[model samples]
Target: MATRPIRMFGDPVLRTRAQEVTEFDAALEHLIDDMLETMDEAGGVGLAANQVGVTKRVFVYDCSHIEEGLRGHIVNPVWEAIGEETQIDQEGCLSIPGVQKDTERFQTVKVSGQDKDGNPVSMVASGLMARCIQHETDHLDGILFLKRLSPELRKEAMAELRNAEWNQEPRG
Candidate 1:
């Protein structure tokens, strides 16, 4: 496994909705492995395939810091809000490095998807785990966490992103 470059925001791949994975193969496995390595190296809880320039529905996450033992990759994931309640917290993205905004997310969620090998997997998540799942799934759907921000906050985030030093640097 190798660390792949995390595609920064404004890259077309991040805006394009990812295609569902139909064949579970080595290429998919490689992407997943690389995504995991990239996320770890970048110190992010979650990294989507699209965030790494792959337009396949896949994401790797390690939310163990916030929720112990909460880590893995998911392919073709779908999640449902579990309750009427919501939680607002500061959320960041690997694609849009250095900018975090208060975003609202469900209190709990039920996610179902397949593993890299095409095996079915499902889980119930709350707290940061649920938030990470929602955030990564949004990437697969071409939605950024900035979209979840309020008008004022989004404007602030946009200005911040506009001037981020990383924006001028070359990405691997």
Candidate 2:
């Protein structure tokens, strides 16, 4: 599988809500494969369709820390907060590279979706995995982690993003 160039933070596609995947076919499979390769190449735990310039409601993640064999793609995903408990953790995104900030997220979550083949997928996650699922899900909804930061933090992040080399439009 070939690695696709990740769409940077300034790309408009990264802010567009992804379309749900209605057909499970060869193209879908190929996109998933390429996403996995791209995520691996970038050393990120999760990668969203928008991050790769595909406005499909899909994301691939490798959260082996939560479950030893847990790693796969979620298509048309829907997630819910599992409890009132929340945690603030530092997060970095593949689209908005070189920036990490503290963001609040649910301590546990239950996410369900279909696989690349249209098979049903479900999982209850916590810790890093839960955070990852939430992070990638935001991408599908056209929300960036930077937007989740506090007002002061978001302003700081915006300044940094403006001066970041990877923030250039027409992603390389």
Candidate 3:
């Protein structure tokens, strides 16, 4: 599988909600494989299709450092916050690089989606796994971690994004 060039911030595909995957075919498989390779090469915990300039509702994650990390691609995922408990921690994204800001996220989450092969898949995870899952789900919905920041933090994040030279580079 080839490592796809990650789309930077301001890319329209990242802002547009990815279309649900209806065909579980060879192309989908290839995309997932490429995404996994890209994520690994980029040293990111997760990578979404939109981050790689594909508007398909799919993401690949690997949070093996956590005990119950959910590692694999989820197609057309539906995620929910599991409890009232929350954790505030620094969060970063592959698309929006050079910025890590404090973000609040549910400590536990439940996600259900199809696998690369169109098989049913579900998982309940906490800690880094949960955070990664939620982060990636947000990408599929045309949302970024920057949107989750508070007003002041969001403003600061916007400024940081604007000042990043890489953000102005042409999409490869």
Candidate 4:
């Protein structure tokens, strides 16, 4: 598997909705592998296909740190609210580079999706993990975390975004 270049916020591809994956074939698997590699290379907890200029309904996240004992991936995922909407938490996006801002998200969530092998799976998540799932899945739908932030917060993050360096080097 090889790391793919992550598209930054200004890229139009990040704003466009992704297409559904109707065929789970070799190409799909390869894309997933590449996504995982990209996420790891970027030191991000998650990534979406659109982040790599591929507008497809696919994202992967590993929130083992937040949830403590749980770890996994989400493919073609959908989420349902499991609890009250929570206060805004500071969030950063690979697509947005060094930009980070406060955004509101659910305190708990129930998501359903398929595994890499095309097996159906569902799970409930809370706290940071829940917020992360919501954030990453939103990317698949062409929604950026900055969109959820207040205008002032978005403005404050602009400088950091401008100063941030994109990881253009290839990762093995």
TM-score, per-candidate, Cα-based: 0.95, 0.95, 0.94, 0.87
Can you write out model 3's per-residue Cα lDDT over 1-172, one digit (the tens) per residue? 9999999888888898999999999999999999999999999999999999999999999987565445688999998989789999999999989999999999999999999888999988888888888898899889999999999999999999888988676778
Model 1, 43-131: lDDT tens digits are 98899999988899999999888767788999999999998789999998988889988999998999999998999999999989899
Model 2 quality (TM-score): 0.95
Q: Encode model 4's per-residue lDDT on 1-172: one tens digit a residue.
A: 9999998878889888888777878898999899988898899888889999898788877777666656556678999998576857788988776666778898999999888778898988887788878988888888888778888887787766666566343559
Give the C-alpha miss distance for residue 85 in model 2, angstroms: 0.5
lDDT per residue (tens digit) for residues 21-123 in model 2: 9999999999999999999999999999999999999999998766797788999999999988998999999888888999999999999999988999899
CA RMSD per model (angstroms)? 2.5, 2.4, 2.5, 4.4
**C-alpha lDDT score of every prediction, in listed order:** 0.92, 0.92, 0.91, 0.82
Comparison by TM-score, 1 against 4, better one:
1
Q: How accurate is candidate 1 locally (lDDT)?
A: 0.92
| Better candidate by TM-score, 1 or 3 | 1
Show pairs that collide, candidate 1: none
- Please estimate how well model 3 matches the true structure, expressed as its whole-model Cα lDDT: 0.91
Over 4 Å off, model 4: 159-172
